[model samples]
Target: MGQDAIAPPNGITHIVWDWNGTLLDDNHANLAALNQVCAEFGRAPVELEYWRAVFRRPLLACYEELFGRPLADEEWARLNQTYDRHYSSLLPSCRLADGALQVLTSWTGRGRTQSLLSMAAHRHLEPLITERGLTRHFTRVDGRRHDGAHDSKAEHLVQHLEAQGISPSTVALIGDIDDDARAAREAGAHAVLVATGLMSRARLEATGHPVADSAAEAVAMLGD
Candidate 1:
């Protein structure tokens, strides 16, 4: 809502991408790290199938549900700290989804405006992007401020748009889940979803929302 209302220059640039499931194909990493944390804290680990279903706002909300109560500030920090450690160890095995790098490369070639807005903590997200050699493709990478509670990706997207002077008309939110689509709508930008994320093709299609099968397709749709 705080963003400028004008349309972007006629060329159609300035993209906002969702990282997990969208870019890095790291939802499995998240599930693995979180489950590892659960084990460390004497809680049951959630399966990836369930994680895909319950992952949502308030970063710690899903964990709280699994832990049966809210974690203390210290406990929350420990979980975050430990999760990063576990996730980092597993990063070598993480792979970029099909066409992700190519799409990012195509966008970068034009020197367009772009950024990464994700629910994953900034600490972990940065290194992952850097390691994958995808950091250079984006003009900016933003995540939660890490102030204990989970930061909503929607809020981050709105803030980033305001700070970057991006207009809603020119900016399209590219993501792969309902949350991503909802955040784009909330931020007054077009939501262009990719089916490659945690969401199923059927579910994505069922929404009757504008969607792409891959990042390349998203880039093409945005050009239209």
Candidate 2:
């Protein structure tokens, strides 16, 4: 049987969700924001496929890849500010992914505990979640502190699971990127990558985690 046929661990009492590309359908906004920055830098605009294929953590690395060279600290900072400004402006046009509500509702109905973890700043993340009316579905919403650094989620995952008193083995992380799977592994939790997010199926599959095409499919893999 294929890897997708493999069942999730038994007794999955909790789920950790990655908010950006996973729960929120902000991929287009992300791409547009990046393209806006590229325009300012006189760089070629990146297509969605290119964005999906090359996106990764340590945000600088992704920028470097796109620019074809290392960015000076000052340049990186400006690019970050530019992208954030454009993305925030585009937020009003963003929406939740298809079937995301159904999946969250079904999981909640089944008495499953769910929490949101994101690399976005806490100040920004909470407002967006609240504005979307998704606050009630999550037991906790953890976002990065306003340190102006795009760090990995591994450390956050460790702290989040520990604070919740949830065993890693009894939890799964549903996300869209390899960093998400890496964070889940670091926390000793199962990683389920949904293809309907920022990264492409090929990239997510390269992480050797089960890849689902949608939130509903991811829930099916996690099981009840």
C-alpha lDDT score of every prediction, in listed order:
0.74, 0.85
lDDT of 2 by residue, 1-224 (tens): 12343345567878899988888898889989999999988898989998888888888888888888899999998998999999999999988889899989989999888999998988999988998899999988989864433468888888888888888998999999988988888789988889977789987877778888887888788765
- Best model number under lDDT: 2
What candidate 1 gets wrong by more than 4 Å, as runs, is 1-12, 109-112, 146-150, 198-208
Please list all clashing residue pairs in model 1, or write none if there are none. Answer: none
Error of 1 at 216 (Å): 2.3
Q: Give lDDT for model 1.
A: 0.74
Steric clash pairs (candidate 2)? none
Evaluate model 2: give its TM-score: 0.93
Query: Please, what is the TM-score per model?
Result: 0.78, 0.93
Clashes within 3 Å, all models in order? 0, 0
Q: For model 1, how does the per-residue alpha-carbon lDDT over 1-224 read when each residue is reduced to its tens digit?
A: 12222221235578898887777777677778888998999987777666666655566776798788988989999998999898878878778877888888878787777888887778767877787677788878887665433355666788878988888767888888777766777777776778776666555555455667777877887664
Task: Name the lDDT value of residue 35 in candidate 1.
Answer: 84
